[model samples]
Target chain A: MNAQYRHSQPGYLMILIGVILLVVAAFVWVYGLQPLEIILGAIGIFLLAFGYKLTVEIKNGFLRFWFGLGIFWKKIAIEQIVYCEPFRGVFAGWGIRFVWNGWLYNVSGMKAVTVVLKSGKKIHIGTDEPVQLIEAINSVLHGQVGVESTQMWSEVKADYLKRVEQALSVARHPRSFEILADVGNHLDRRFTELEPRQQTWENFQRIITEMGPPSEYAELVNEDKKSGRLKLTKLEMSAIGVLLVVFGVSAYFYPQMPERIVTQWGFHGQPSSYMPKPVGMFGTPVIFAVLVIALIVIPRTASVSVNIEGFRRFYGGLLIVFSIVMLAVQYQIILWNLGIKTNPNVVGIISVSAIIVWMAFRFYRARRHN
Target chain B: MNLENWQTQLRKGLLDIVVLNLLNRGPSHGYEMVQTMKRIDGLAIREGNIYPVLARLQTDGLVTSYSEPSTDGPPRKYFKLTEAGQKALEDMNKHWDQLISSLESIRKGTGL
Candidate 1:
């Protein structure tokens, strides 16, 4: 089969900006840490994730384009494209902005292939090779390309579907229908790609042989389904319990504590924000508990496509980290009330940095695994 | 020292150049490229693996693809070399020629 072709234009400028922000954040952190450093670091990460590059791909008759990690993307069907031409006009600033009539998706440079869709919308795709990109689009619009006969696919498709259904029946998983549909789609694409002479039952059998036995596929699907079921492990539940205990202990100190509690501190380790005795003592713990509970429940209740089970350990670790940080803050608050002076700002900075480092490590490992 | 391993590594290393040289002739699809590679003995390139190579090439801005709608089945994606790809191929060809000549001279005992 003709697989997808992809071209990516690196947003050197955006990447540089991200790098600069990160460097500045690091410098600020080293000199005097503030919430602004965290904000800058966050924006740096966001830019790196979503503004680093622009990629355009020709796949399955769609002209798919995206900017950085596919966070922002658009797809246009080839059939919708009336024509495309090499664009030469006034230079517009880059990174997905509204042009004269339509939108312009560019990472760098003024050279682009402006595609005119059937609905009179024009999309200018920035590319270094504007002429070649236009030529590629034109060839697809006008060229005579070889295609497998639908008649040939029709001959074996029924049998193929039947076999696939039979193969899926043994699994008895709840997601069997979804799996069947996915397998059917894959087989359809595979069958369409086969040469006319190879579009026979015999060749299909050979292909199936290469794909392995039905039992193996069923076993795989069953295993995947089994592993992916969402449930809180003992460790995760224990972490939540520990958090509750920490909050409970903090409540124990309420009677002995002062009228107003130091809930927030400034960069100079001085108390900057305070709350009334009741709200200051219990408010943060209550908010943190609610946040942790929401974090635990959202993935299970929400319609997230990702298999949360895969990140069960990571998620558990995160909850533990949150609990530990909460414990430290609660302890510091108690100490402050008991006339023990401690820098809560330092504690906050350390906790936040630790979490950031752990997350970065996790992200790096996930990328390496993929 | 393992001849088979050496041959495999050599072929793998040369895949980019080989693919670029193939596309330099004319535009071709993934299957066509794989079929052509299969004809070259010892290349042993798998059909599934060619797409990644093509994708990487495209990502590098050396090649670009567009789909031609098939009369019968799905649209066929065709990849062609860009100007950068052409220049890359020329540079690789020159380097390959130099390497071959150097090896030939050594084989013939024509050392300085």
Candidate 2:
């Protein structure tokens, strides 16, 4: 097939290196006769066969590339591409290998055109003509060619599109119009594919039935956008309140505490570790504060996508349980410091067992829901 | 739950993988995907429900869409699976196979 654009970059340096390696391997085999010659010869042959050149072509709505006579080839659809831009990165020395979040096809030089796909993966095609390659990709992305927008629809198709719009109206999403257009395009295509006799209102209704209820579309959009923003729920507020209460209790007992306070206990109800009064009394609260901040910030700043809203309740409950556990520990410490006998080991065991059981139950519930 | 409700829940969970498997054959438009899904006896899905699933898939970067001019009507939006989508489908299929085999063993009163 004729491509809209094509470019090839020769790997002169790679060929030179391969030849040198082959010559060295031959010398080693002839003189020293070491088994290491086999490894060197194999690598040399592999490089010469697959690293001689990189060819990139954009044709039939696909970005196709191959290295060294198409032994290793990859094809990406134009529709899958989000955007293409010039890549200016340090010379990492590549020969069809993976980069950060995608693959890099290069024969020589650091200059390349990176195409970011809708899947968030990227393809870096090393090319001497980066500008031309980018232009070719951008033209297709902007719908300048290959794919054209449709302006007209039949009356029957229009009604179907309107119903889809009406159904999706409940979503109130910013991308509603775009989604409507997508559905309209789909209906138009389906209408055209059906036999002329089967293009009646009855057939259209049947098609819509197969599509599912209109409200389902709204639900999907709403669910997909549920994690668009992070907000503190009532449970989270309560968890924070519990943490503050724990801190307040610690403060109440701070003056009565001894300079050295037991912070950790052994399995036999004996104190195993001790800390200064202030550190032992206030350390747990400070750590809890940091943990809370992290819980709030991580979902927002983490590089990977996560649906925090899906388990918002679980997270809030976890925080509350953790705070309560800390509070119990603080109470035990205060009592022990006040000359009241208490088994620190029992408290630790009970707290840990409760947490494990709660977590197991939560996981079971989550599995059932899924 | 009633059998119908149980079946509905099953279909909802399976919808994503089912659509991914269909697209694995080739790129197809929304209507074509819905129609093809209807061919499965117990897996008949509503036509409108497919769009939202497609929308979610596209948002997740698992699937992508492009428009093509049609001779009989307006342009058609066709969806194709991305590499990530293909990988996800493989994993889902593997899990599904394991689930089926485990269930079979349970029914036969073996592999307890």
Candidate 3:
């Protein structure tokens, strides 16, 4: 009902919506490097927190648009929009998505809506589909043709009043406001969902891929050119990037290539039986590869599953174990190749002792202090 | 695999072509794209991959997105071919074909 101020930068809202997905994904993937998770998660939350804006416009007669990040967006022309209903959520991943024609669309803090488009494509706009918007489209598409300006003005006034009431309500009961704020957030998100009035396949993949993940439900998040998340896709990609870099560097400087592969076992290089296999130290990158693989394989998402955090833990644990194993293997081989005989037990104990102690310290800090 | 070195970039390049060609069929969602990518090859694309190339295309205005609901859940951002994206794919395909021919020549010379 109120006149919503148009935002100058929808990009902010887009980035904000994106970060929320990442934080949720990180919380779920809880299987990677602690420092990396927190570092990335913090950045994500920051962008999202500052990214709220309003800039939905319908330039052509063909579409009605609402845009934002955190929520989902579904478009239906007035003719095709079969019904706009306030209903329970669908697309119930971590949260429920809005709907129209039995399809998932967007999610705000908590509401959902479904719409049937003129083209017969069904869409689930957000539940928080600004009622004022519904009326505008209803009148516009069906032709408010000659509805008195008074009715439109009154509608705008009514919406403004609702916004005012919500603001006052927040001031009165801060805690309840927090809950409502969550609800309001759902609405804010709903706005972002419309960032691209047209969420084509290219758009969806593009945005979601940028989010970085091992999310169990990467598919749930949408990407359409305008903007979205790609955490899980990016994670795999970054790994691929690393692999390419490793191989590329190896190819570029063949001599720098490490002779051994590290895993749960230390510097485990097999002899090619050509020239006393060079006593090369391949420990670091080998361990890095193991860590990368573990993290990527641990599926996660901020949607239905809260896996990022768990995934990080799983991957981190794997990395820690692999690192220790590789370290021992590396040291033992160094001794062997040098013609020095160190007792297996002595080498193993000496190499693993420090890591074991460090891990214990990490455990105590993670559980209690950190 | 000699592919080891250029794999990521090669894969990234291939991703551009795959997404555009698939969208040419009709608008599709992120999941649909990944599944189709798998059907094509030793292509080795993960479910989590290519979302970026889609993003890059969009950033460059070669593609656009819109949401549609499915019986399953949340709205999916459906991708369709944009004129610019289609043109880019055509160019990529030409170069790819030429590159294959050049590599074939190398294979023949080696006579293995």
Candidate 4:
């Protein structure tokens, strides 16, 4: 028994015109046919051959449901369907909407019969007589329990598996095929106990769903590789800020010093070398700023994965040590210009040791969970 | 700590055992098995969710299926547990009992 339902022609007319132009263009280029007449002929052929329509029919004890001039369809073994229900929704403004839930085949109405397949995936046929359609399908489905088609089941499983393997071949993840195979193994074990549907397409879909999208999985894996790397912290930022303030304070004393500033001291604690005042005062901070900025930007631009956690901790610790060294150097230059008798190198050595001791203690305390 | 994610994890953990227990009663197809699982309180097994687990069980030789004529519509592939499956179920039950006892003590706030 076959019953056909056709949606109104207005929706299809727009699509028909769109396809006709492409067909006409192809025909005109290949056969040198006149564009105007070829277009007209194309439209006629399209309407005659593949006009849009929705259909439901009973064939070979299966309720064959399809839509759109037989371009797409699904066949449900009457016994395999548990039930059919009418679904009413916008379904994203409808005319063959492939939404998250399932494929919805509707033209203009809100009413449709949702045919739930035993394996999963639903075929929604939009119809004004949803109740009647449901009754008809149910009547056919409830007629008799016939022999399950093992051969057909095998074919469906084989076809779906092939499609999945093909998609897996070019999937973004390097281990996509392995992941799918593992999932299949898991599924095989679980299904043995559960004894769920033996159908393949829905099973394959479930495997893909569980595994997640290949692109997303690949991105997460990549992110995890980078996540263990280091970054700058609040303590480092505060240390840098304090160093900048000290640099400014030292610069304030620069103008009071001689033109040729004392840069290096001899073993006898005598001024042995001189640089321009600006070089002695500002050179360290300028160099420090450039190095710090480069360090910050290098991580962002580098293609190579950096151990960020280790790098940030090391960088933060080094910044504090280096900042103190810069201040000590600036302090020595100023005191020497002011005629003070002190070894700047000794000042640097003592300050470095003190900072090192302080940092070690702090790190040790932190490690102890204090 | 997303509740839905936690529930999904819990479901995934228990699904294999649930399927095995359902098959222990009698052979049934996938859709029917999902419906039965849904009847249990707090289980939200979707129809699509059961197939891979079934595939996994079959791969492990814990269960087997055969084609049968349905009472109304087309044929159904009905699954039943193998001898290995029965033994596995026993082991699983023992483990489950141990876990339940441990959780019971923890719930009473009397033991680690």
Candidate 5:
């Protein structure tokens, strides 16, 4: 079937001027009046040729719309269109405009029908009889040609799928992947059932939001993996018990020892008067136990995602260093009790310096990695 | 929250029944049907919007299309209601009347 609708008339002023110029040119040519009339006639011909308004027609389910005797034209299948409504965005003002909504083809009047393709782009066709033009388009779309609009729907579906894929690219959590997959399926199922009004930008925005932010989702899903219970190996647990028992049994000698005992020594390898007997004997073991407990508890509570292995290594190093320091203190105290002269200043300085250097190296390496 | 949005939604839902009812009258082309629909006040439908509803109706075997000659242009395609279309129109009209009556009663604070 074929139907035609001419929305705009030809430019009357230009046509009239062209005809006058042609008549004047002919008169001059016949009577040998003036050569300038030839130039005037040529100008009129050019204006008349280009100044006519555009026309639109529907033939065989396709819309054939053109301007000024088909100088500029386009043929669109009506079935690919989703909606056709009257548009009056007058400020867009005239021929072949690219407005924010979409493309506009017009001549003079604000009368136009905006057809939204299934791909979500729009085309505004200027028409004096917008209603009639729309009716014709609707009829073609409802007929056998209507099936082709599914192509447009598929294009829209592809765009949404692409967005979902991008969101999944940075996704860290398996849960986020699952959520996005579900959203993709849901969008596919609901899309065909939606009316034109319901298929707005807001709907897509909502869907994206429902998928959640990729970065935040990743952080949340991996949060639980950051921590685990602080369990010690069987051998390590037995060693801890033995160390604590040995220190406890030695504590019983504090009452029998002299009131004053050497606890610290100066630079020279000579015994130095130190603290009260109890201070030298008990303080070292108490400090060691407290440090060990604090280290174990602190690492266990922290999120494992923020370098759990690093924390474990650091804690183990500190435990070994403190244990060695406690052993030196115990040996010194026992030697003093046996009437031996000894100074721990050299050993103390070396161990402390070694621990400081090791800690500094760990921090420097971490900084480099970051 | 726009009331116009809700109105459009309502119109979209009723469009199928309305198109079938129009075809029940006589065989007419798409443009003619749109023009007739335009006569009703506050019923804003464009010629382009009517096709999908008609296409859907035709798919359901309630309507069919044929070409007809026009006075001043190419032959226009016209839609005719099928046997199923007539039956659907009847049922739709009965349901529409019941709905309208029920809504009217609700508005008047009477029983449905």
Candidate 6:
């Protein structure tokens, strides 16, 4: 098979479908699914997304090829990339990315595509629009070759050139006979030649390399091509995961806060009160445990991707800080609910004020004269 | 009519047409196709999201590519559809037609 194509499997769709499933899981959690049941459901989601594929591949050179069958996707030869740029805000910098020449390809949320030269310099481009990206990379690559405008072929035929021309014409809706006639003549000529038939066996492989559009997605397809074991990075996604282990220990023997430990040791006697929960022994602790998971994990779990304007950096920084603040707030709330000797309202006010100050500074920095 | 929104909708609906039309010309590359689409009046924000769809079509054996040394950087990929892709395009057109007729019928009957 030519390097131009990518195979998508039930595994690929598993990740996709996982998006909805995650939502379902959340709903189940919120609506009182048993904790064990919810945890099991989450495990199922992780398994499906990480199903039996263990390898992925990416070809580098003039055409980068990505292919795989398991956990490790194809290697995207760093040498092939030009540069990785971020879309800070204008685009859905978070989810989508585009290459400058205009071909959009999304590297994974954590990565972006760039073209690298033999000498090792990189330039940013997107995977979404391959045509423009190719042209841009071509311009950089073949600086000596004068650009030839490949006009849209206007005639209707089995060929794609004519179809583009027809679309262009339809788009323009040329209302005059002179323009229409000129277009008719323009569309008929063959734009480019397909290789002669005898070497089709050769062409098959050659064609894979030659077809630019689909190959644009070779890396992503390769990423989905296969994998069995989960990536360590993927496993660390939910803080709740790590927290679950802590939950058991915390439930079995509540971890003492430094202040409580001090009192317990008699350095500060009088048994400073710390209500672990209100009524049901497990109720307060469970809610506290869940809150800890939410505060420390959810924001960090967000998927990151580059956009035209440095969106990756922007989101990364914000998510980290957001998670920390949530942790602080959750801890405070849990403390207050337990009748700990602390004024949570004061802590809440301070946190809210800090967030405001942070936002103000961020706005100032974002809007400051560059 | 707000042109941007209209263009966005048109681009989404016609992306296949755009992709098909680009391929019909002769084999071009993915980047080349994207550039061509961007030049059209209403397309915007090409991302990783769209490529998977293209890959899906290719996996079904609709489109194909071959690499050629790029004058600038790495070898560039050129793309074209197989008979399967064209057939899929035709199928898409049929669905489009049914959708259009249904909408048109609704417009006539409701007069809203």
Going through the candidates in order, their DockQ values are 0.02, 0.20, 0.02, 0.04, 0.01, 0.05
Ranking by lDDT: 2, 1, 5, 4, 3, 6
Better of 3 and 5 by TM-score: 5
Q: Which ten residues in a row have the lowest lDDT in candidate 3 chain A?
A: A92-101
Q: Model 1, range B1-112, lDDT digits (tens) per residue? A: 8998788567767778888999998998766777788888876564433544564566566888876755544345688999999998899999999999999999998964
Candidate 2 TM-score to native: 0.36
Instruction: Compute the interface RMSD for candidate 5.
Output: 19.2
Q: Which candidate should be chosen as best, given TM-score against the real structure?
A: 1
Query: Which segments of model 6 are wrong by more than 4 Å?
Result: A1-115, A118-370, B1-10, B45-50, B108-112
How do the residues B1-112 of candidate 5 rate in per-residue lDDT, one tens digit apiece? 9999798667767777878888888898666776787787666564334544554465466888876554433346678999988988999999999999999999998974
lDDT: the better of candidates 4 and 5: 5
Worst 10 residues of 4 chain A by lDDT: A220-229
Candidate 4 lDDT tens digits, A1-370: 3443223322364356546666666665454323223435544454444335556665666766544466445566766564566663334243554332245665544567766554433456666677677666766665433113222333333344344444433322222333333333333333333233544446645643543333332322231232222334575577668667867787788778888887765444555567888887777677777766665555444322122333455556666666666667767767778778567657546554656565555435332310
Q: Give the Å error, residue A50, model 6.
A: 37
Query: Model 5 compared with the native: what TM-score?
Result: 0.29
TM-score against truth, every candidate? 0.42, 0.36, 0.27, 0.31, 0.29, 0.26
C-alpha lDDT values of all predictions: 0.64, 0.68, 0.44, 0.55, 0.58, 0.39
For model 5 the local lDDT of residue A93 reads: 50
Model 3 in CAPRI terms: which quality? Answer: incorrect
Docking class of 4: incorrect
The most accurate candidate by lDDT is 2
lDDT of 6 by residue, A131-188 (tens): 4544544444434342232111111121322232233232221111112212222221
Kindly report the docking quality category of candidate 6.
Answer: incorrect
The superposed Cα distance between candidate 4 and the true structure at residue B77, in angstroms, equals: 44
Question: What is the C-alpha lDDT profile of model 2 across B1-112, one tens digit per residue?
Answer: 4999899878988889999999999999877777787888988876667777787787677998887765445446789999999999999999999999999999998979
The parts of candidate 4 lying over 4 Å away from their true place are: A1-214, A218-232, A351-370, B1-112
Model 5 lDDT per residue over A1-370, tens place:
3364444545455467667878877765554322234445665565466546667877766777776766556777776665465663545355554442356676655678777655434577777687788767776676444333433444454455445434434432222322332333334434544555565656645544443343433332332222223456343364377458648755766666677776655435445446677777787677777777787677555431222334555566667666665666677676766576555654565455556566556434432321
